[model samples]
Target: MRLWLAIIVGKICAFASRFFKRGGGSSLPGSLARRIEPHILIRLLEKATPALTSVIITGSNGKTTTARMVAEVLKHSGLRIVWNRSGANMVNGIISALIEKCSIRGRLCADVAVLEVDEANLRHVVADIKPGVILVTNCFRDQLDRYGEVDTTLALIRMALKDAPPGSTLLLNADDPLVASLASGSRCKTMFYGIESLDLTSGYTQDRNTVTDMNANMNMGMNTNMDASDMNASNINASEYLPHDARSCPNCGAYYEYSLITYGHLGKYRCPRCLSSRPAPDFPALNVVAQGAHGFTFAVGFEHDSEYDSIGASLGLPGLYNVYNCLAAIACCLLLGIPKMIIEEGIAKSSSAFGRMETIQIGDRSVLLALVKNPVGFNEVIRTIASEGSNKTLIVCLNDNFADGRDVSWVWDVDMERLSRNPSFIRSIVASGTRAEDIALRLKYAGINQEKICIEPDLDRALELGLRKLAPGETLYVLPTYTAMLEIREHVRRRSHVREFWRA
Candidate 1:
């Protein structure tokens, strides 16, 4: 009775949301259903999945992209896919998605459901749904207002794993020591995936020497700016590469020593005190045969056959972070028994997600959407844009909306100095969204000249001004947080006459 009642009420709300032209139809209905029936989500999962395989992906970054990649690959594999493609990922959203796919009598037709869950919501969602596969994309300091500390976030995820139903395979990011540590205590099977060799020159570099800061002001911005020192790690004040807030050994609390430095605190590192280290990846991205703005090509650690082993799979996205997401998806599909050729085909043909490195073309004007939610993610995106070596316009949107975590201090951690250092890389910058002025102030502090920066808090006008400022052959890069991306992406979609995000 509860399931049926919740479904009917939720379905009515979802229909009303669409008819009212509300952007995301999943949330209102889902939230209502959950409030109406506390166990509605769990019952929906059981109803949908006795005949279907369910995959849950959660992490600070890359959940949407990674989930999207897996969903597309599964579709190509000929499974009737039913997923929350619009990124509505709470337990409530999961129920609503299942409610849509299941019949009024509660029969399901889908073969798989790829659910992208939010970091904080993982514990609740996993408690209700025992997914066949749970993929943890590398965890980083994200939305401090909501997550508090990354370790706290990790602890929550760890509990989720501990409580996860038995026989579930935990797919993890082997390159991330923090993520790898989840395996130390969890009683679950684990599969790992990571980049074998990162092309740092593409947009970032690793610190080659040892740097220690026992009094490090640890936070999400642990690796904010470590590129200005001529002296190596021998000097206490020397510039250090920052990333992965837990620079000290997780086991012994001693400083981690580096073997190879990649962006942030990722790459090869071993604890000198406890001898803890990064785990070996099962599906390693090997041999970077090709790399650049368009994408990259690499070989997998293992293959279905000898002929398939040497095949160069390409991740059709920019930056090492995106490559990491692609690796996660590849590892996931392989575990799910997807054909290598089909996975490769999907990867090669994969387009950008709604905001992450999305490009919008309006006749001759092109706007690139590189969504930036946290300091770490934002830094990577900035590095990618600066490395392009092209003079472009920048539209940066910073929102303190509920969905955007309500804290805007992360703008300070972004190395806006990258653009300031280049001087010529960003022809002009327009700051938009609720926290536009704060971001503009951040740019100024980074040494960007005030004359080159424009403050337009209104998103619509900011979009117009940004496009008007775009010169021929030059691009406009729209870098926004989650809420900012939603608003900007919607405006661009309407103006471009393209379909809405969920419709696709």
Candidate 2:
């Protein structure tokens, strides 16, 4: 009786969500369903498990991209997968996706389910749906207002891992200090993946160092600009930006010196204090070559699994960040015994997440959507544009909504100075959204010509002005915060005759 009741309620929630235009579904209904029918939904779904393996991908930046790659690789291995391709990582969204694919009788029919879960909600949803494999991409400081700090978020993720079933495989990035530290404590079988070599010129580097006095002044405004010296004094020191070279023993006071640095503090580090360092990975992608905006090429060792036979594969996403995501996916797929050829083919054909390097055709003009929510992400976007070798106009939308950090002060931390330093490549700059002026000010301080900067808080008008300023065959790059991206996509859909397939 209770099983039937929960199903009825889930269906009703699904119906209501559609009627009210509220995004709903996933284990959210399971929460309410559990109150009325404990264990019923889990037992029911567990009984109808699909033949395709289940994989859950989580992290701060690359969850969507990694999940898409894993799904593509599995598809190449002849398995059908049902995934939330629209970048919906919440509980209700996952449930809605499952409900959409499941029969009215409540049975999942796909061969596999590849889910991209939000880091914060991983604990809540993982308990309800025990995934067979968990892939953690990487952890970074994001949305300070919501996540508090990187350490706090990492602790929460650690607590969630405690509940993972013993047999489940944990795939982690060995390069990330925070991620590596967490994986060390897990008892479950773990597989680590990371960049084997450090490209110093392409990686992030700290210009200065600082020390923090934990007790000196906790009352400083969140937006206050502190130099590296002050940042270190405040205990907010920037770790080495190279991921591969970061090697410190968190357990002891000893430092693990890295032979190379990847990004941030992720790299080969050994604790001089404790004699502890990451063990060499069992499976690593070799011969990585950046293929510009089309992704990268690399070879996976097939000895671990015969399913992958191809020597090289290329991904369709843009930026070095996508390369990190692809590496994570390749590591896991190789462990799963996927064929090399299939992995390569899937990667070559895969597209990026919505509003994440997604391109659209507006009449004769091409618009590229790049989501920039934080300084780190924004810096990468700017770097990508710098490497493109073409002069272009930029439409940057800034919003201070709850999801985009109520404090837009982080903009000051960004190295917009680089953009200002280069005037030849960027012809015009258009800023829009509630915090448009704030972004404009940052650009001006970075040395951007104030004459070339245009601010229009109204998104539609900003789009018109920005588009009008573009020359034939020229591209307009759109970089927007979370809410701003949604608004920009809506405006594009309403005005332009072109189809907006990359909707959030």
Candidate 3:
């Protein structure tokens, strides 16, 4: 009786959400439905199926993008999938997605479920929906106010995996040391994917410096001796540093040696003391090509030679970080028996998931909104901008909202100095939002000319001022934290002639 009532109420809320755009019901009706009757909702869905195959993608950055890719790949394989395209990763969002798709008879119609869940909410969602496969993209410091540190976020994922069903596959980023470390001692089959191309540089000097520090800290903590070979392998070559080597053994306080460093100590590494290194990958990415904004080119590495053999594919998103994301998604999809052609087609046609790399046209100019809440994410955004050949303007908005964390100190860690070097390409810098002054000061300290920097606390005024400076045929790159992105989106929506198309 309660279950029926909950489903009926959920339908009402889902209907209401359509009208009340401001309320979360429209965006996250599942969360509200779960709150109203948790057992009823779960029971209602469970009654329809005895077993389920579910795939969950979680990480600090790229969860939405990876989730979208995974869903696309699965769809290409002819499996019906229910996914949350919105940037909703919480429990309510998951519930809402389910509610939106489920029939009034309470049966889940999809063949599989691919969800991009929040790192913090993984444990809650996993307990309620023990998925068949879990893909962990990478762990970085994000939402410091909500998640104290990267390790805390990692710990949550570890807990969630513990609840996963047996025979479940764990797809992870072998390039990210933190993610690789979590796969240790897992009972599930683990598959890893990362960049194997040696031609790609680690990035700017600041990026190299940060990687060195992370490696050194990892080495020091493990009391490992860094031999000459290790040093040579870890040193930066062609602007980017070496592939990430394991710094320490997660089981023991012993230094790990690395055969290569992918990015920020995320390559193949083995603890000399414990003899533990990255387990051999069941699937890896090969024949890589970094396609700037058009996406990536690579072949999926698999363990078996079946009719659906490995084939090349292209992604539709921008930036190198997304290449890593695509690899992670491909790894999981391969494990699920998704054919190579489908995976390629899905990636080639797929777009970013919401603000990950959403582009909007404001008046005559194009505004690319990239979300940067952490050092790694911000660094990637900076690198993407530097790689673009055209002269562009940057509007960086920082906020200390509860979601963004009060500690704006991470700004210093971000290599804002890179933007300073390419002054000619940067037409102007507009620093705005609650932390507008802080962003301006950081840019100034990084060597951006004071004459070109503008600080506007009011977003509307800032957008107006920033857009005025952009010449015709030029695009404005707007990078903001979470809250700032929402506000910016709202502001963009207010413009009468502009149309906002949410990324899938």
Candidate 4:
């Protein structure tokens, strides 16, 4: 009876939230519902449709985009999908999504629940719901003050996987050593996905520093199809490319040997002492082609299973990080027995999540919004910005709000120094947010001229200044932390008539 009341109250609150323009009420209603019924999530899951298949996606990065991709593909394939579209990924947010989908009598109307779970909260969600598929994108050093070390994040996720149902499948990233390491202890079935070869220097305009960093880490002599011989460590020092946390193998306390380092310690790696290595990926992305601000096209290889050898896929979202997200989504759909044709079409049709490489038009200028909370994600946004050719206006908003991680020190870990490599690509920089001065300082230290940097603590003023400075035909890239994204995106929506994030 308490659970039933919780559902009724939650639905009413959700309706009021939307009607009053209280910003989606993505967590508040569920939080209130949970207070009334402590085990509301568990009880609600018990009443869920028997045919409903829940998919929980969690990691340091790519959770929103990956979950959005999976949900869009499944929905395109005609399966009803209930997801937290507003980027609310916590336990309360998930409960809110479920409550929104549940009818007045407490019946779930969906066939699949594609949820993006926070790394620390994974254990709680899994305890209540045995997901049909658990997809982990990658684990990196993020929210250190909040989540401690990357190892703790991995351990928390590992603990959750231990509780996963027997029949569930774990789709993991083969490139990330920490993520791939989870398969070793899990009782549930596991599937891995990764990239076989990446050559980003050609066919697109990109951050020369980013491309150089990747190429310097890889053997330039390798052809489009890489082999064991190409894995020789003659290209560059792998340590320089790896994040401070991922330099060593997770299995043993030994330094990892890598044949390739694809941005921040993710790539082909093996441990000599423990004899542990990156497991062969069941679904491998081959011949990845970056389309600048447009996204990527690659071939999905199904070597072990399926009828077709490989299927061509494309995503409208840009960056190499998104390629991994796409692969994880494709792998999850395939595991659920979705047809290859449906998967291909769904991928092509899938769009970016809110504030995740979302583009808005302001008169003749194109403005791109990307949320940056951590080092790896921030660096990828920088790469995307640099990749969009030259003469671009950049606005970087850094907030230390509770949602954005109180510790602003993580900005130092980002590869801001690379921005100095091609000083001409960025026409001007507007530093805005609670920590605007901090970002301005970082850019100055990165060798950007003081003349090009403007510190505007107010987001609205900073956005106006950026647009005023933006030349016709050039793109303005706005990168902000989580809370900052919400604030600035609301402003953009009102001015440009873009759909509200919840509606999108």
Best by lDDT: 4
**Higher-lDDT candidate among 1 and 2?**
1
Q: How accurate locally is residue 219 in candidate 3, as Cα lDDT from 0 to 100? A: 56
Clashes of each: 3, 40, 14, 1
User: Could you give the candidate ranking by TM-score, starting with the highest?
Assistant: 4, 1, 3, 2
Q: Which 10 consecutive positions of candidate 1 have the poorest summed lDDT?
A: 206-215
Q: Alpha-carbon error at 61 in model 3, in Å?
A: 1.7
Candidate 1 vs candidate 3: the TM-score winner is: 1
Candidate 4, residues 21-69, lDDT tens digits: the string is 8887889889989999999888877887777788999999899988988
Please tell me which predicted candidate would have the highest TM-score against the true structure. Answer: 4
Alpha carbon lDDT of each predicted model: 0.76, 0.68, 0.71, 0.82
Each candidate structure's TM-score, on Cα atoms with residue i matched to residue i, is 0.91, 0.83, 0.86, 0.91
Candidate 1: stretches off by over 4 Å: 199-241, 303-311
Model 4: lowest-lDDT 10 consecutive positions: 221-230
Off by over 4 Å in 2: 1-44, 50-52, 198-248, 253-256, 305-311, 496-504
lDDT by residue (1-504, candidate 2, tens digit) is 776666667667766755674432334554555566656535555756644456788888888778878887887788767776657776655654665556566677787788888888788767656677888877776787787877777887898888888777898877676687777677678877766642323222222221122111111212123343322424442222212222335576455555543444555656545677766654555665656544566665434434534346565665656767888887777766676677777777777766777777788887888889876678678767766555678898999998788989878766676565446767888989899999899888767889889999998898888889887777788899988987787677566553434223
Question: Candidate 3 at 419: error in angstroms?
Answer: 0.6
Comparison by TM-score, 3 against 4, better one: 4
Error of 3 at 314 (Å): 1.6
For candidate 1, report its TM-score: 0.91
